[model samples]
Target: MRAALAALLLAMPAAAQTGDLVATDALRVCADPANLPFSNDRGEGFENRIATLLARALDRKLDYVFFPQVQGFVRNTLRAGRCDLVMGTVAGDELMQNTNPYYHTTYVIAYRRDRPVPERLDDPAMKSLRLGAIARTPPIDLLLRNGLIGNARFFPLAVDTRHESPGADLMQAVADGELDAALVWGPIAGYQAKVKGLPIALRALPTEAGVARMDFFITMGIRAQEPEWRRRINTAIRDHQGEIDAILRDYGVPLLDAEGRLQPP
Candidate 1:
């Protein structure tokens, strides 16, 4: 009887052996422990929520390899094989295989509610206000082209890996009266302004020249060798796009449709 059973199992299709051949263990994700709106150690960010949803769809437990999202982040975590996936990355990033873009967003202007918020880069009001931006970011170049660089306060883009995100600091400055306005990434600014309850206004920028094109499509990052894994993830993303969009909405992400209109959740 045992010999007959072994022969029967071996004769079954390859698909029938998928459970034994493929590992459905934990989904090990690489994330920043302190990057809010994306991820954090406390699992309060949108990326954390997305990770959870993906793991559930794959019928696997969720786990994280926490690292700061500074220089050498990929080398130390994903490339080092400490984790099998990164939940959030630019779609065209060359460092790893990327899944289909899950969301698109643009840079935003953040300012205290008590002050005037300029909807466009050329607003006359921008010239009189104290502008702030992260160094080397697209917004800085916009400021330069507009002749606003001389008065703009620049925050460093690269900080010690141990430090908190400088993006948060720039947003906080707008809320704390340190800056009249700030140009920051849309998701971060939206999360800070709407979700985090900061007293600031967040507005999307209108398309303009020399603005470094603030928009971007974000995707999940996987190792080059993980083509099958990437396909699975892409399937998951496609299957659960509605749920994913809801998660982004809950986190106050400024989502944009293909036509560039604001997609209200």
Candidate 2:
């Protein structure tokens, strides 16, 4: 029986490569070709830079499969074996298992600098202020849950107004004085607002549990069955911290510490 089991184990296709990862060949990465500062096939995104570093560490070439950043990208690529790993992913995203977060991001309130900053999201002073937010977005949901505003006054149409590119519009509205403020992804929002000199102040809001915030770190996703691959990826993250930091820095994505404060690049 022991001999039979040993034979079976030997015959099984290796779920993930094992042993010294430095000797490994290539890391198949799933990425989006057009997304900036993330995974893109043009070899310009942060995820792409990190992928290159990881490949070098493992002594492997990188095999990137580009796809749009849309629903089912994970299922169709990484899950279906078209790619071995996802370059980056939200930690608690419902799609796949993730490794320890290599970095965290902040979601800040971007408002006209001339306007009064609310002490908190529920502050009474904000009661009459028009805040632009993306429809079906987490921030919008948080606002609704907090009873921050009525459905009619939200913007770009109304509180229920969803847009394919709401973040861009939301920032533009704030710049144009169409809205007093908007809650958006910190890195992207901060970058755009700063580049445009929109005269906006990006402030981190105090958030309650379960809402995505600067305090929570995001992680990289890997195939669940590939424990060895996951370990190598995590190891690469630790070993290439400086390179990763630089990549994010170049893209204007602030690296946040455990307390959610921006850290020095």
TM-score of each candidate?
Answer: 0.87, 0.78
Q: Give the poorly placed runs of model 2, Cα more than 4 Å off.
A: 1-24, 151-164, 194-198, 209-214
Q: Which candidate gets the maximum TM-score versus the true structure?
A: 1
Report residue 30 deviation for candidate 2 (angstroms).
1.1
lDDT of each: 0.83, 0.69
Residue-level lDDT tens digits of model 2 in 1-265: 9999998887564533442322245788888776654655579767888888888887888888777767678878877777777866878876877977887876677888788557687677776777877555567656865677572134332222122345566787888888888877776576565444567777765567776453457688876656676777788889888887777777666567766676663
Worst 10 residues of 2 by lDDT: 155-164
Candidate 1: 10-residue stretch with minimal lDDT: 14-23
lDDT of prediction 2: 0.69
Give me candidate 1's TM-score against the actual structure: 0.87
Clashing pairs in 1: none
